[model samples]
Target chain A: GAGVSQSPSNKVTEKGKDVELRCDPISGHTALYWYRQSLGQGLEFLIYFQGNSAPDKSGLPSDRFSAERTGGSVSTLTIQRTQQEDSAVYLCASSPTSGTEAFFGQGTRLTVV
Target chain B: AQRVTQPEKLLSVFKGAPVELKCNYSYSGSPELFWYVQYSRQRLQLLLRHISRESIKGFTADLNKGETSFHLKKPFAQEEDSAMYYCALGGGRGSRLTFGEGTQLTVNP
Candidate 1:
């Protein structure tokens, strides 16, 4: 079976620019999540989506970060006015449901210069 | 707030030697504990969960409520086991995971 997939394996952008990272979850997966991994740091949860419910944005670092999952499938993480501190690996994951083990994507390495 | 803690930033052991990766967590309620592993060039994946009570790749972890820990252990380490290991905690119905800083395990053969 196909696993979760993310686009733009690596991205380099100047500070103050905006970038969008895509994620395609495995078929039939109803839950999606986004996280960020900084050097030598743990995975920082960003947002979560389950079915048609409102997404959980508690972990989002700031108002500039947002995400959307359409048709209960594809998801996109957008960072507005990127900062050098935002440089990190953006990871996406999906699960059969809220409590199941999650399957992750290769991640998009975002670099802000 | 829920949190997962991996005290050691790195662990090294020779092949066939015993291995233990300590993980402690703090949460207000009952939490689900998990161990996730990421091999070089590979995506992060689940190694084991405390609920399953099963070992994967010769690794096992026990959930201790008294100590609030879920430590991964292997009787015999393998060179292939060299990778980054993260301990995670899931609480609430949404099942969002809080991860630890991670431990880089280097198994020497």
Candidate 2:
């Protein structure tokens, strides 16, 4: 892809339901990132991936939130037993390497009702 | 841990007016700072980075190590410059990027 791509531009799920968000980073990019954008909290870092391994997952809010990247390209973020507080826009970004400028996707707006 | 802070949530200015968006970060190690902007209905994109010292779209940012600040500035603001701006900090290799709360700038005509 020319830029980072995220699927299901918008999503609505009920409490206790599970939701999956996807991200397809630009070809040959080795670094990927995930973030959550909320009303006042701003962009909260959720995870970071280098190649197919995630070295930084400290930003994951809770045990319910998990993510994985495969083939050093596509990534998936899964939220189990979603809560209303989880309503926010999930953003994905990719960079050629660590410490470089990142390109972001349109983001996936996840609304948990 | 590295953290970025953007104090202003909203900023407004008239066209051709000078504008400055403040950004501060706290990190023990040398950090990489960047500014990202998102216009209405568009994806977030990198505006400039402190390391490059290059200006984009008339915007420039300087990294002050002593003050731990990387503020974005423009002499004359244009209406097209209206957007949400974010300050980000990177902790070098194998580090994750941390973003600030963001500042929403509105350059009115």
lDDT of 2 by residue, A8-54 (tens): 99999999999999999999989999999886446778999987554
Candidate 2 lDDT score at position A67: 92
> Lowest summed lDDT over 10 consecutive residues: which window, candidate 1 chain A?
A94-103
* Over 4 Å off, model 1: none
* Chain B TM-score, all predictions listed: 0.97, 0.98
Q: What is the lDDT of residue A91 in candidate 1?
A: 97
Predicted complex 2: DockQ:
0.69
Candidate 2 is scored at a TM of 0.92
* Deviation of model 1 at A54, angstroms: 2.3
DockQ top scorer: 2
C-alpha RMSD in Å of predicted model 2 compared with the true structure: 1.7
Per-residue C-alpha lDDT of model 1 across residues A1-113, encoded as one tens digit per residue: 48999999999999999999999999998889999988866688899998888998998999999999999999999999999999999999998877467889999999999
TM-score of each: 0.90, 0.92
